[model samples]
Target chain A: MADTIDARIWRGGADGRFETFSVPRRASQTVLDVVTYIQRKLDPTLSYRFACRVGMCGSCAMTVNGKPRWTCRTHVARLEDGPLTVEPLRNLPRIKDLAADMAPFFDKWAKAGGRFVPSTDAEADFAIVEPASAERRAADAGIECIGCAVCYSACDLVSWNPDYLGPAALNRAWTLVNDVRDAGNADRLDAVAGDAGCHACHSQQSCREHCPKSLNPTASIAGLKRATLRAAWKGGP
Target chain B: MKLRARAETLLWGAQRASAAVLAVCVLAHLATILYAVRGGLTAAEILSRTRGSFALAFFYGLFVLAVAVHAPVGLRAILRETFGWRGVPLDLGTAAFAGFLVWFGWRAVAGLFA
Candidate 1:
């Protein structure tokens, strides 16, 4: 706790600039720790969002040194720069002081029909699905998203084309696409296809590289492309 | 002739389609020379045979026009996409290239007719 670390956290409204804070650096101190220390001890009014400090909640994501990351798991020592400069995630509407508005980000998930729609009613017989099956395997690979908005912030396509469904939402839709029990697979596939959806993704692989969970959204998007193309061809042109 | 961004895409599609046509035309032209000149066909004999072939002349002329339009538009996009820069200099260069393709290809196509 002897070393003095300079922290620059984004402060104020949508048009705000970086507000600087200097604090005593501690051993094994995560970025979330430093931010918490500044808010609690230095300034009580400083605003930031975090639920679970252990990184499962996916709420502490902020851009560290121009790259989106889960600040809860990111160590202050690992950042190579002299001072850690924190900014709100890019391509999302900023609220104030490191917290960006996630409504649009999450709304696209609904618009993409990412939620599961059950096929059977209350009295229907249970359908058994093998965990080793191809559909189940595809779902297993992409179902770990905690809605952190990291992939959404990392995608350049989202920055360029604001209407694009983004990686996380599309990834969720892909998982649903493989769910044989879901009644809305065809509608979901049709919704996630075409220009403003997964087709617009240039395979930049930014989301793949930045996901803290190491989940590959590109593979899921590619799967959706193949499925949609096959479905489109089989049914008609 | 339109300059909208959407028009650019259509022009690019046309250019690509034309290049495919030119590729076939070029191979056919080379193969025709190789096969037809086996018996040392004279210049007079070549003219006599080519003069009546309006069908061959039209097809070759279409190939010539395609090269004229395709070469310049592709160079235009290449300059913009690769250099990370775009404006008057790039546009002028593309226009000049199109003019060059049209002039050279048309000269050849006209000679085939006359």
Candidate 2:
């Protein structure tokens, strides 16, 4: 292992450029550690975002060596032996060095009706959901999204169609769709049905490929496609 | 929003249905071509076998219809995603393209099966 790792980090907004910093390599060091070293020792102005310093929080996701990944989870030893190129997540407006504007990403979530709508009031008894039920299983498949925007950055459809609800949002909607206690199925189906919704996805599987949690948003989107088709066929919703 | 969603969903369904038809038609068409050429038949010989055959006409006509339906929906998406084209103009444009495919595809099929 080299004593110093060459890390090229993005340094500006939309019209940004990469700035190289020779970060001291450490055993089992993560990509986030390199960024922190650059910020603390080399350049104090170097900006980035991270929380929990673990994979659970998706806020540390960045384009590392041309791939969107959770930097906190990515060990430097796992990367190919070369100068590391880190950039802001794609398909979102760059706020500064490594942070992207998450507003548009989250806004699409609302557009896709990602929020859970309760079917019963709090006064009702606890709803017993079967863990082995098909709906529960389906919901479980995509409920782990942390909104890190890695899948959103990885999606080509989101880049092509700005109005796209994106993989993360649609995945959230799919989980909610499978929720037996949620009353937003019809509206959520409508939200994720159109050209900018599930129909927009070409099933490229980029989101599935880039997801740190290994969740399959493509399958979730396919589920939405089926649900929407059934709704359309029944002439309802 | 409801109307647009329904229309888009129907269009997606149409594309998938037509693609399934195209898949079968394409396989049949390829198999027929290989079978026709296996005995070293000329273009004229193949035409003679196809001409005046109602089954051939119907099959080829179905193939052409599927193409007419399938290509335009895909092209509409490409135009929208690649070139940022949309709205009524894009719809009308793809519709026109579909018409062109139907006309030209049927013309070719007619030449083969007439």
Lowest summed-lDDT stretch of 10 residues in model 2 chain A?
Answer: A51-60
For model 2, residues A139-179, the per-residue Cα lDDT tens digits are 99999999899999999888888999999999999999899
Listed in order, the DockQ scores are: 0.07, 0.65
> Model 1, range A1-237, lDDT digits (tens) per residue?
338888998998778988899988888989999889999999988888899988799899999889999999999988886888898889998888888888999999998888899999878888898999999999999999888999999998788667789999999999998888998876676677644576656688999999999999999998877666655545521
lDDT of 2 by residue, B11-47 (tens): 9999999999999999998998887788697888888
For model 2, the local distance difference test gives: 0.93
Every model: Cα RMSD to truth: 8.2, 1.7
| Fnat of model 1, as a fraction | 0.00
lDDT of each: 0.81, 0.93
Identify the candidate with maximal DockQ.
2
The alpha-carbon deviation from the true structure for residue A106 of candidate 2, after best TM-score superposition, in angstroms, is 0.7
> Model 2 clash pairs?
none
